[model samples]
Target: MAQQALPVLQPHPSCTACDLATWPGLESPGLPTRVWDGGHTEPQPKKALLLVGSHPGVEENVKGSAFVGVTGQFPNRLYIKGGNLADFADVYLTNAVRCSPRTSELVTPKAVAACREWLDQDVRVLAQCYDEVVILATGENAISSVLQRKESLRTFHQGQVADVGGVECSVFATYLAAILLPSNDPSKILAIREHLLLVWRYLKFGYLPTTVKVPPPSELVGSRVLDPSPTTKLISLDVETYGAFERNHRGRLLPRQTVFHPAKSLHWDGVQRCDLVQTCALSWRSPRGGKLRTKVYRLDRRAECDRLVSVLQRLRQCCVLGQNVPFDVLYLRAFNHRFRRVLARPHCVLYELQVLNFLQNDQRAERSLKNLSLVLGVADYRDEAVDLKKGQRYRDSSDPRAWTYNAKDAQATLLDYEFLVEAISLWYGGDTDKWSSYSRQWYNEVLWLTVQMSENGVHYDVEQLGRVHDRHQVALDWLRDRAKRLWDWPMSGKGSGKARERIIADMIQQYQPEDLGLARQYSRRVKKSRLTGKVSAGKENVWLLMGVVPSRTPDRGKLLAYRRFQRLRKVVESYTGPLLHQVSEEKKTPNQQTALVKGVAHPSWHSVPSYASDEERSFGGTSQCRITPRNPGLQTEPPKIEACRRSRFPSGALVLADESQSEIRVATGLFGDEVFIQRETAVLG
Candidate 1:
């Protein structure tokens, strides 16, 4: 007799934070992803577990921990009132991702790149360890930390298990403990407890038990980190000056620091150089008075970038703090991108805390530094009023106002920081272990993340890419011709050199190379699926991009096409870099290959796809093929794109396959035929 499949309505354990699909790990032929084939199910998760949402604060960015933050009070409240902090079977807890994003704007691609692996790691481990993993989605930010669609989640509601490691599970949604009280139904403290209780029952034993309050803080459930000692003391900070010429809600410019000033010595772009950079920072200091003496750093030259990294390296047990850290993080990131090689590992940050408050606080009022101060009320900085505006003259006057302002801001921040730290001691953490523990359990959260995610390592394939450049000319030229043919556009060198450069640049601005390159790698597939599409997805993110360079010989090109991809399957297992995936795609599909190319793992992070196409069959075809899995989780899908028959397939290029469901022949993409599967798999016992 056919039995009815359990009415699954939630994510699987291997689904990561969002129940979205993802590769379990980067063993081989693995790619980052958020969605699973089973889709979202309504099945129950392993029982006796706690679900901790992601926080946008110090713990997350600075310490690199998931929960156990100031904002964690939201989930904490649930436990305090009804749910048990560790009442679950194994207390399976995780965010949608392991790391916080660099930008507050949350570009679709970046989000996927940053968290795909985190999602997969948690789910895969949990799935193997428990039969029912209870998920306590603490609002959208928390939910988004695990789930893919952040804006669409409802507070204090129930979720159906949609998918897992191609399995089923269940999720119970609830208001983030951060949500303000006294407004909504769950607005009342009593109601908040009630919601938590319901979630608790749902998580405890698959079926909802008519409980009324959260189980007692689940018996000191998790640990923050495994290591007994701290990693390093280096933090990156960004400041947003209060007195600025900005008036618009979108952070406008009105001669404010954000606005570009010709007189400003910091040669930078956008608000960073103008307003953000104008902001000051607190540097290495020694305790002098009631408050520690501080050093204010004003980056007047490019050398400051290197100097900052130097400071981070020098400080062994210190942590960096800042307001709205992304500003500072981005600057550092840009430096890394431009100069090549950023060995900097960030520590605590004030900015990460502020952003998390925006997502976790659940308040209607503007969540600013002032509001944060008000909420914490840890100090009396607001009362101390000095004619701060008068201090403006010193900003551009070249006297010493800038340094003063930087010093003052840093000191004031330092005072508040002390309070924030003391306050943090009261919070309990989950997960213990250096490699896996959430840092908050032991030390600062954001600081830990910086170390765990340190540019672990970067590798590139130069020989493989050389071929990519040769065949990419025609496409590059065509893109230019299209631009030149337009109305008042200039005619590039004889053919279309200038046109090519501009158009290609525009395309680089886009993640998809199909639009600018000779090959049509279904970028739409990436966009629609929402993958990170990065190089290191299997490890950090799930999305990967591959290219099919024209082979040395016609037959050789053909054989190298898929065979090359198969070879890469092995190297990708070892390199484990970031992926450039789309938002929706990161939720489910593995790295969508743009093309197939032989891969070699070297410590060089130089990989740029050619912006041109080919005329004489760019890539030949390959007959000798090996099968591999595309994602991280269970043995699923194929490393090879269906039966990828080729004619000029270019590396980092995508082509369609399977008429009814054609996919981009992404190089390093997966096939589940088993060639890449590991013979010795680890089981959770």
Candidate 2:
């Protein structure tokens, strides 16, 4: 099918300062000639919402309405669904640049400046119609126009409230609808839902209900009861670290090059950051129901931390509890030698709230402390007091906000434990022994092993991995040059995805299987879209081209070379490069320096066992590789790319492996399967 003709707009009589006026196409027949106004149809909207998009699209220009195109309809659908809108008719919609640009890129700063007069007119009309307006700006241009600034989108955060034209509005600025429309990622969808919910919440209430004041850390610690009752069986603890929160998708901290970690420590921003324990909050509460006696320890102050050490020594006698308690334990051990020594003592019982929650609820249920607290009716101040989106952390010892946040976390953990214990007890038919046995054998045991693995992290051969990474880079560069020379197309940049698709389609149309020197059976296997008439460049097609050989036509050569290039790129990007980064560059600890090593990486591991009959136990790598044991994880490294596994374990390390049917044999023997056991023994023999 041929591409549709581009839409064109006639030059406005008022202005002709830019080339957008000269951009050509067919004259729009049914579209509005004049700038469009918002809320023209609605006389009295109960809850007025003014949505501002960057510019009108081809479809919107053709339809004579703002936000009616595919991109616009996506957000409109979300707003109607999530925000409880009666319909699109209930809300006012307009664009910053009223005239549809030939392309979004053509709607320049100068064009936006010229069109600001029209946008201002729309805002004024909408503001007057409603006593209070909720403005949702969906792009940089719209945000800048509404706020009357020349700054970029980074200057604003999502769900921010601002005064527009002397009218207070619960305003929100986010990625354009066009950008978000193509993404099917659940996180992105959830984020938009959260953003819309915040907008509606702020519209109803004057402010977000997150603000809470607490007694200062000094005062809290001063009044802290160090000695708990002899009968106390559980103590819940929580910690606020300096650089553990606010990570991007790749797990890199947002606040890089800060004093939180030494500049030398972040050569590649090690897999696990050198996060410091800012404050440790420990609580001893009545499991029945009452307020918790929580102590917020300022770890930066040596005097205050000593008091915390005394309490930690007593933890062995009582069961220590917290949400993700292993994380707190890891940071605490790193902070003080005495704390580590106290924790190393045998018979230490640790109760992790996350693990317990996982067993009690569905495996997919969110187990964050805030979420758990909210559902348990404990507290909902996760967003209050701190701006996590802005990468807020415990920057200094003097900040009371971090201390209060820490205190709240400890208190909430205690409350969550109380709730979960009862919930689990009731779930187990009030059989305390059954639940206790399960917790002891599964949750606590896994937590102990995970903490131990993290403390003694595996070592890697960085120099060897670096050599492999460099070789992959050289090969990739050669392939890119070859591609550019043959097709005059850049193969490794922003437009590469689209370029790959076009290249694949061309290869399929122009060349036969014999022409590319591939088997005829492999040809015509690529799936083409029925609607778009475009060939898929998905992983399946790429794999089919793996055996392709160089041929006469540049199309075949390009396709074969590109496929090889992608294979090498994946190894470097996913395996070798990240493995090299996983090795820490921080200054070694005293013991590490004595042994002449750089640093250690504490990659995360997770295990969750569902008691249900159908679901199997889930376990393996969580962060560093984020792959599972089934055809994945660090343990399942391919033979060619064995640098990580080969270099990881030290000399004299004892590696364990489970023989096939090990668990099956034990179960069958326990159930008195004498014939099966004899057959198993004969097979093994």
How big is the positional error of residue 670 in model 2, measured in Å on the Cα after superposition? Answer: 16
Angstrom error of the Cα, residue 251, model 1: value is 25
Off by over 4 Å in 2: 1-218, 223-230, 244-275, 286-289, 344-346, 356-395, 416-441, 470-474, 477-502, 508-541, 544-554, 581-601, 606-636, 643-650, 653-685
- The prediction achieving the highest lDDT against the true structure is 2
The worst-scoring run of ten residues by lDDT in candidate 1 lies at 607-616
Stretches of candidate 1 off by over 4 Å are 1-279, 283-291, 301-310, 332-343, 346-351, 355-366, 378-394, 397-401, 427-437, 440-685
TM-score of every prediction relative to native: 0.28, 0.58
lDDT of each: 0.35, 0.57
The digit string of per-residue lDDT tens for model 2 on 1-685 reads 2222211223233455544555564133222222223323233433456677777778876665666787767665666445654332236666666667765655666666666665545445555545556777776677777776743333344445566655666666544566554442233443345456656655556444432234466656653535455456788788776553444323444443232212122333342333456677777755456445666777767777787777666555687888877777876776666777876636567888866675455322235676546445565653566665456554454566666777788777877777767877876667665357665656677777877765665554566656777888899889888888878767776687678788776666544465454545555576654223356776677665544535575555666677787788777655565555432112122211111125334455455432211011112224221112221134544445553433344555435454446567778879988889888879879
